[model samples]
Target: MKNIKIILGLVFLTISSIGFISCEGDDSGPATVDGPPVINRVTLAINDSTTTVGLRENMYRIYGENLATTKEIYFNDTKSYFNPTLVTNTTILVSIPKETPYFDASDELKVVTSEGVAVIDFPIEQPAPEIDSFSPVAAGAGEIVTIVGSIFEGLESVRFGETEAVIVSSTSTEIQVEVPEGIVQSYIFVETLGGVTQSEQAFGFKFVIYDDALKEGWWVGGWDGSEDFENTEQVKRGDFSIKRIYNGGYSGFQIGNGGAPLPISDYSAVKVSIYGEQNVGNLRFSINALNEQELGVILQVEEGQWNDFEISLDDPALIGENELEVFSQIVIQELSGNSNVIIYIDDLGLI
Candidate 1:
């Protein structure tokens, strides 16, 4: 046979060339190798500004292949659907889903991977500035108020009730604070970042009351230190007068040109007018400020019969003296013995 039929055709071509090299070494084994997964880098984190409105927690990272099988993530156009968890298929841990109720300031974030999607462009700031209404509703300690409505731009503080107000100027709407001196009817809060806004009503400032008829040569005397007293000659019939008789026991009334020195500051308070008879015993009318070494209670003439007395000099060394030498005494140390009471002293001004 022709050499055994050419040795069976060379052994059937060496068994079909060893089954074509074992199907090319099992198709170059390594599990069907396809390639395409070296993404190297991608990261993002959020919160530069998003002043409240709803869910907004972002964090993402992807460094290559199977990125833990990333699912989806997109911000701005909103859409984050993730469930990835594969720290080393080539790292991937994304979670950004909770921000959708309006309040986007130019947002941009994306990361969807089956092999595609990856973007980042964050910038969503703005929302931190609020304080509305405040304009002379009543401010008096030192006054200087003006804080009117809506976002004032980063303005950090402006408080008055607890103290700390002296902004002076700012604008986005308005701000001019200064009312800080133990504010009494308080309520004025204005901090920024869009949180803390108070003052819809409640503001007060203004207090200073010191009075006692104008002084400068104030005259009216008679108690031996005579300027020749005669308010109709200390009446004793029809007007009932005694001129000056403070019966605490020591007696009263003595201001004389004979002593000549009475100007006692332009006045802070002191006004007298009295007429009493019923055996008066509790009569007091004092105003002695000869430079005040401490002794100024001013006026108090009470025994019931005719009354009109106003005295007040809040005590500050008896206020602005040019010559200051006031004196209008009366108060008989609660009459101890010798029943004799009758009072009458009129006008005597300096307020």
Candidate 2:
């Protein structure tokens, strides 16, 4: 009986040992995860490492290891939305909220994973201003030019080369500024809290003619002597410009101040600054000569803004060099279809 009991005890101890080993060595159960997420670098998702500073509401990528289990992300303590499909073992794609507070130094990016959480200090900043394009690329002083770009928030000022432009209106992505005096064909500049940005291409300005409204060289007629035209203070430059409203009575409204004929000896072209009610086109400009060979140039003026029309004197389609030299009257006939069309003229001169 003692020998049998010993054999049974040995067998029971062996079985108990096997059970313990099965539980400890089994790979079918939940596996132990390794290290926490490691962040190597952060870069723009569009252009890669070109910019380390992430733009608000723009997509960015975080490169690291062990990120597949990422659960959440935060920018400056504000939770950022991330897509599961964009999260992988080595990268996490996220969109920085547009409302994320900018210029915060203590901002950090947090990544929570199943294994552990990781953090990296980051800075949230407004993207520097950028200028994609501007309207009326060439205009005289006091004419409004619209600037379109990104990150115009907190716009401080605008610059035309070295001259400062007056801000008309500013938003997150657009700015309207009047061309300041003394601006040449130079780069358009913009300043904001983020930084200053300049146009890659240069803009132009037209030469001055009758920019001052108080000038006495204008002789406007053809409509009844009623207030058809006036040298009003609504000028694009100094003080005044000629504003005309056609009441559809005259065959064409005439503009001539009876001043001495302007010599086109040193000039190659004539430019006029014009603004109309709405998208008026096909304005006919005639240069009359004592020789009876009239030259014509057509101008297409945009609506609701100042437009500069330049007519080349040497263009074969317009006039001869001799006719341009002896031109007497600069006639502008309003054929813009609007019956009661309103137009503003400034800086009508030879360039």
Candidate 3:
């Protein structure tokens, strides 16, 4: 009986030892993962960098396990320049701080994590559009002027000083905007996504208000034949008349036939009063210089009331060798169809 009891005790001790070894084998701790924290997405918001406007708020999302409750965000470099705030364990909210070295539109964003550091490739672009030039600078207050310049693709607003001009239309390279009311100054500036460009001051003086005596030497002409010489004229009242004819035909007026062309070489232009009775013919106005003839063509007339026209003659040839003469014969001709339309002529001058 003593021997049997010893065998049972020995068997019980062996079973307990085997159970302890099995428990030790199953004691492996939790598995560990090795890698950088997975980032799902990153976002940024920016205001116009060119102007004094402030920056806007934006978001960036981070994903994966082991994300610490505290984190750091940066821009451009890892030196903690952005100083983003930790909103949550998996998210961060940051405001773009005032740039030290000046904000560049090409700057990017980056983030740091407890697992590792990750960078965002997308750059933050915030720029103000600019305008280089505006056509018809002296337009009426309500006139539509075309604003031209670079980087007009994303225009936000256009302003004429304090007043906001109405944008008529926009394109990648150009924008058509109308002048606002209560604008007295001829000079103005245009604002865009890039910057502002100043416009040349408009000539606000009324051109037609000048006295008739001030226009003593102006020339006037038209191809339509009228009973009164002064009524049917197209070119402004100036020294020379340039008329155009159709189908290889020619028409012109000479200031002085007796002298060797007018001698005044520094005259401004030939002025005439003209209206387009028809669109089929062109008018040519020629001036006789001592040696060469300078000529210009007028094709901007439509059948209507008389409009004043001016053509500059800076060329040295149109003036005569002696004093300029006023008793010159004006010639007219039809280039194609002999419409027999006569252009009127009056008030020809050199000044």
Candidate 4:
């Protein structure tokens, strides 16, 4: 009878010891265990399907043996937090931390217990950065530019053309950077740990009216026997610009046939770079082709140097009595002396 009683007491002690293995609310260190931890499978916390990769800030369930006394869990060497009560002898429910190491990862999920540690193959990462558009694409060096997109959380670098830009500020959706020097015309790229993303269009010209030739349904330009539109000698923004001489008698360079007016509501100014052959002067600059709708302003130029002009859309001279809804066309004529004038036009667009 005494032997039977001893056996009963031993059985009760063993059961109690097994129950105490969880150490409820006591996850400060590894628990006392009998065998090494074994990780069999990993799955999402909300379902039972197995998974090979885990996303940051997402909960996952690890199924294995000897996991009841789990003291630590790590994904890609990033320590993760697990609830003590949520751990069992066969499973551990934990969430991967947001600051997990994304690059150069070991791609392993490890579970540490009192006896030994077990690891399973796992890849953890975040979504790659994306680019929607950039504001004020036409900007000089040392100017602040903005890039709008999604998933810019882990910004590694931002480049304009091949030059690297200095990040002024950033958010999950937008990033502001200072334009680098020597960037004539190039695309914008934003890189992160996930991947690199390139912009949809080139960075410089937002709405290119003309680069090498007429664009965006421009039907007419340069009237009265002006030289060819494509000239490679005096190039500015792109491969070439319109560098030619016009007839002396009231001859002008006219752009557009008034088919579809330029949408200038979003832009603040009309930007263009011009260079003159000789010591040029103020010329007749009008917004339209017809005489009745002409609002002329004095367009100034210099000799032997390219000057980038930003004509304000709200200038009183550019908009006379008629309110300028959009920029329809432009007419530039040498009215200073009426002699044959040679000029070069390049990088025509809106700012």
TM-score, candidate 2, is: 0.39
The residue-by-residue lDDT of candidate 4 on 1-351, one tens digit each, is: 999999999999999887788566454345445599999999988877899898888888898888887899999988888888888777888999988865568999999998789998898876678789888867766779999988787799999867899999999889999978655468999998778889998877556777788785676666663755689878886687986576665667787634565666766766678888853666666675533355666778887888767666677677676665677787777766646678888878665
Could you tell me which residue pairs clash in candidate 2?
213-240, 218-257, 219-256, 219-257, 279-303
lDDT of 3 by residue, 1-351 (tens): 999999999999999999878765532322243556444555333321222222223333433333343256555442333333444444444555434112344354455666677654544444445556777543445678787765565566777766788899998668888867634334555565546656554422222211222233434343333233223234433333333333223433333344333433433444445544454355545443332243334434445545444544553333423344432433333443445444434333333
Each candidate structure's TM-score, on Cα atoms with residue i matched to residue i, is 0.24, 0.39, 0.31, 0.58
State the local distance difference test value for candidate 4.
0.78
Local distance difference test, each candidate: 0.50, 0.70, 0.46, 0.78
What order do you get sorting by lDDT, best first? 4, 2, 1, 3
The residue ranges of model 1 lying beyond 4 angstroms of the native Cα positions read 1-106, 110-168, 171-175, 178-182, 185-188, 191-193, 197-351
Question: Which 10 successive residues of model 1 have the least lDDT summed?
Answer: 205-214
Model 1 C-alpha lDDT per residue in residues 205-272, reported as the tens digit of each score: 22111112213343444332112234454432233333444434534454423244434444445544
Candidate 4 TM-score to native: 0.58
Which pairs in model 4 have colliding backbones? none
Model 1: how far residue 238 lies from native, Å = 53
